[model samples]
Target: MTTVSVNLPATHYDVLIDRGLLDSVGSLVAKQWSPRKIALVSDDNVAPLYQERVAASLAAAGFDVHRYVFPAGEASKSLTVLAELVRQMAADTFNRDDSVIALGGGVTGDLAGLLAATYMRGLHFIQIPTSLLSQVDSSVGGKTAVDLDNIKNIIGAFYEPDLVIVDPNTLGTMTQRDLVEGYGEIVKTAALEGGEFWQLIETIDSPAELISNAPELSARSIHYKASVVMADETESGTRQLLNFGHTIGHAVEALANGALRHGEAVSIGTVAIMRVFEDAGLAEKGITSKLRDRFAAVGLPVTDPLLNSPQVLDKVKNDKKNRHGHLNLVYLTAIGHPEIKSIPSSEIASFLNLSVTN
Candidate 1:
């Protein structure tokens, strides 16, 4: 078991990760100051698993717990749902000192964090990430938002959570699709941190094996994210590295109308982008092929047949990640050695070709 503390500007919290951390949540919540009133937010899918236990923890801690469960899946990330969530908070009469705890995967963490950001202008919240994707990336960054008009996370805010509780045991119930989707991000973090960590992950054959008792690996990934976020909170410059394959991935996701999970699309996008690096002679050694096969082995697609679709190129050209018509491309020189480059419109099709094909 390894415990990592994420110290953001507004609030500081600990991420407790291990096989049996869920059973200890009550004691953990007890140590993190006392809030008289608390709003516990989750979706239908997650409520049955841990909501009762989370609510019980708050109850034992003497908090007035108000539970709200939204619909499950990525489709629920929208304005209409967010409006109703805010209404629920207002209807419950929650105030500044009171806190909201997001208990679910990425979808729940994002929507709940945004609720904390907007309620009465600002409030406190905690993140209990059930899925591996949420546990490593979305839950800790304070990047909260809802999707708008098919664009991923178009409406949102940078609201830090009061605490983040990551229990790997919670990942026991994840679907195979969900676990593979998360491996896309796990690969992304390894790229940023270094090749050594990436190599460590390569030895693990399945998502279940990797998430088993690997708190140190998980915490190390979060630590890399926090260190980068602390330096580039607004994502003005340096943090663009985090967008490695997301540019094309988001475009594909929007076109699919949320058909593919974020990490699933990213798995394909990362492979596609890495091929671009290889074509340009910018990539180092075997990292690209390794990434492609590793994610594929876990059920994440490395190639998108949809890449041949006409709209794919158009959407990439128009995505917000573009700057004055130039696409901000995060390409790899090698695993752990990332470089950002601007690719011309004329060359995008070639990169798209490599990215779209297996």
Candidate 2:
């Protein structure tokens, strides 16, 4: 078992990672606060697997619990679904004293967290992220949002959770593709941290092996994120480092129109941006080659077959990270070190063209 604490200016929370932490969620929530009602928000795919277990645990702990399940996938993370969740809570007379428990992947966590943050003027939020992607990244951070008009996370809030319980056992249900997609985020994190972490990741061959080594690797990733979030809670400064490949990644994701998974698109974006870094003389030679090999070994796609460079550029121009039409991109001079640079949106198209040609 490993515990990572996130200390912020407004509040502090602990992320507990272990093999069977889900069994102890009742006690964990009881220790925090006593609520009149609790809402368990999950997606349709995950509800059949773990929802009953989580709800049973919470119910046994002497709490009134209600379950709200939505259709699974990124498409569910929208205003219509969010509004429906809010309506359900209102119909149940749920007040601010109630709490919301997110029990699925990144999509569940994002939607439920937003529900908790806005319902009845804000309710307590707890995260029990089941997917590797959510457990390692989105579950810890306070960033919550749903896609607006196919633009990812354009509307959201910075509402922290009361506690995060990560049970590796839940990952046993994930498909190989889901697990591999998650490794993209793990590799991105390793690239940002560099040094021994990067070296360790370079040797990883499979997601199962990575999960077997989760205690050390997960802790390292979580601690790095905690440190960054602690330094810059609202993304005003240093926290931008976390968006290492997201500027390009999010654009590619939006362009895929739901065909590409978030991590998959990010994998392609990571390679594309690193190529740009190399061409600009900001990165060492052969860096892209090394990363491409590593990404391929882990079963991630290094390039987008359906990639349309012009459309990708258009999507990036509308990215939330852009400030008044200028893009602030996070680039790496080396593994584990990242810097933010501002470039004209027009220039990004040319840079990506160069990347695609090379």
Winning model by lDDT: 2
TM-score of 2: 0.97
Clashes of 2: 3
Please list the residue runs of candidate 1 whose C-alpha ends up more than 4 Å from where it truly belongs after superposition. Answer: 9-11, 344-347, 350-355
What TM-score fits each model?
A: 0.94, 0.97
Q: Write model 2 residue lDDT over 66-150, tens digit each, in one string.
A: 9999999999999999999999989999987788999999999999999988887799999999988888888987999998877
Tens digit of lDDT per residue, candidate 1, span 1-358?
A: 6777767565666777777777776667777757568888999998998889888877886788899999998878888998898888888888888888899999999998998888889877788889888988889878999987667788899888767888887777887788667878887888767857877767767766766635756787888888888778778787888998887777777777767888988887888778777866888867789788778666777777676677878888877777766787887887788898887877777765744554
Evaluate candidate 1 by giving its C-alpha RMSD to the native, one decimal.
2.0
| Weakest 10 consecutive residues of candidate 2 by summed lDDT | 349-358
Clashing pairs in 1: 272-355
Report how far residue 330 has shifted in candidate 1, in Å.
0.7
Q: How far is candidate 2 from the true structure (C-alpha RMSD, Å)?
A: 1.3
